[model samples]
Target: MVSLIRSALLLAAVASVALVGQASAECETIYVRREVRDLADEEWRVFVEAVQKVMKTEKPQEADGQAMTIYDDLVKQHLDYQDKCHGTPIFLPWHRAFLKTFELELQKAVPGVVAPYWHWGFDSQAPHHSEVLSHKYYGGAGQGEQSCVPDTPFKDYKPTYTADGMPKCICRQYDDNGNRIAPFSPIEELASIVENSPDFDDFSSRIEGNPHGLVHNGIGYGFSSMSSPSDPIFFAHHAFVDMLWAKFQERE
Candidate 1:
């Protein structure tokens, strides 16, 4: 009887292990296609020309109004029109694709031009001394290093790409048995996603209120309210966050 009971326990343990392994596989980060490399020399000039047009009219308006109107109408509108992709959790895929499109468009418009994506990753080293997203007052370590831990797994963990050349990371979704379930909830799993990513957030504190708000002094200038476009990192940062959401949508 004792031997039979021991055998049963072993079988249960194995089953639990299998279930956990299966769960983690369910929630993994998905990568956006890196087709921004397709922009030809001629197209680059057209893109730059668009950028010039956009910059001239993108006046800051504190929180909202003309600046936002011009941004949505002239800049964002053009990029979204080109992506041809949509879906809720797919926010990052669309934005990354959109940024790439915008970059390529600018290059097409300007010729031999390269536009930079405002990277929040830089703040991990930027001299700012407070956490960017945290309501608390901790920023940088004062030595130009991040004092807070990163929430986004990609920020610190680099995933091995698939044969098709797509990057992958651990997804934030988990099942009842502590296994990850795919189609992860963006609103639900965002905090875990952020906390897990490395070199992403300088603000050690988790974001409260709206996860979508702009940074307010955690890392010098973190995210800002998006009504206006004064903050440079706004679009890129949101785009990064969106990417995490898209990955959560695809599960094994």
Candidate 2:
């Protein structure tokens, strides 16, 4: 009886250790080769499969009454956190750490998935801008107008560069100093509320009163802005940002 009890406890201890190992395996920082960027279509499909597998491991949460899966939920949460924390600076690292898990997982699942940076070489060309504007968001820029057209093709085009050297898909109409050419004022319709709402201050204040963060505004470029999801480069830009955040946290 004594031997059996001792053996049972040993098994329980081993099981606990295995569980801990599995939990830690959820995600980690791993690098994918640049060659993965040039993968053939069939190979790319396999890569996607691997990414799906890792996503399965993550088990991202879902929004109520919405069809979003775990991966979608993770991206949504990180985007919201970035919106709130971007200007504050300290939270940048935290948000980046959150992104890294997804990056590593995707890379792990899809071997040789090359994460590419934004290729704005396509941007410096006039014809390229014309091609982009024809899509949707750029149409609002009006040719030769003093409006801001982002480097990326996303909607609500706000151009920004991540501290880690990644160019954000967001393009805004600002001068070289990052000042808005046309300020976005939610208070145009509610001047009274805007003037009195001491609790609200900042670009994303509209998000605070927003029941849904980006969802209500539509995630990733807005409909009036970019008409589709972020370009493939978005993942790489975010991955670099996420890596930066992990490094930043090490110091904190």
Which candidate gets the maximum TM-score versus the true structure?
A: 2
**lDDT for each residue of candidate 1 in 19-135, tens digit (9 for 90 to 100):** 354444543533232222244545434433555444444435545443442333423342333223222222233344445444444444454444433223333333232133222
lDDT of model 1, residue 2: 30
List clash counts for every candidate, in order.
Answer: 49, 15
The C-alpha TM-scores of every prediction are 0.31, 0.35
**CA error at residue 131 for candidate 2, angstroms:** 12
In model 2, the runs with Cα more than 4 Å from the true position are 1-45, 48-67, 91-95, 111-114, 121-220, 223-232, 239-252
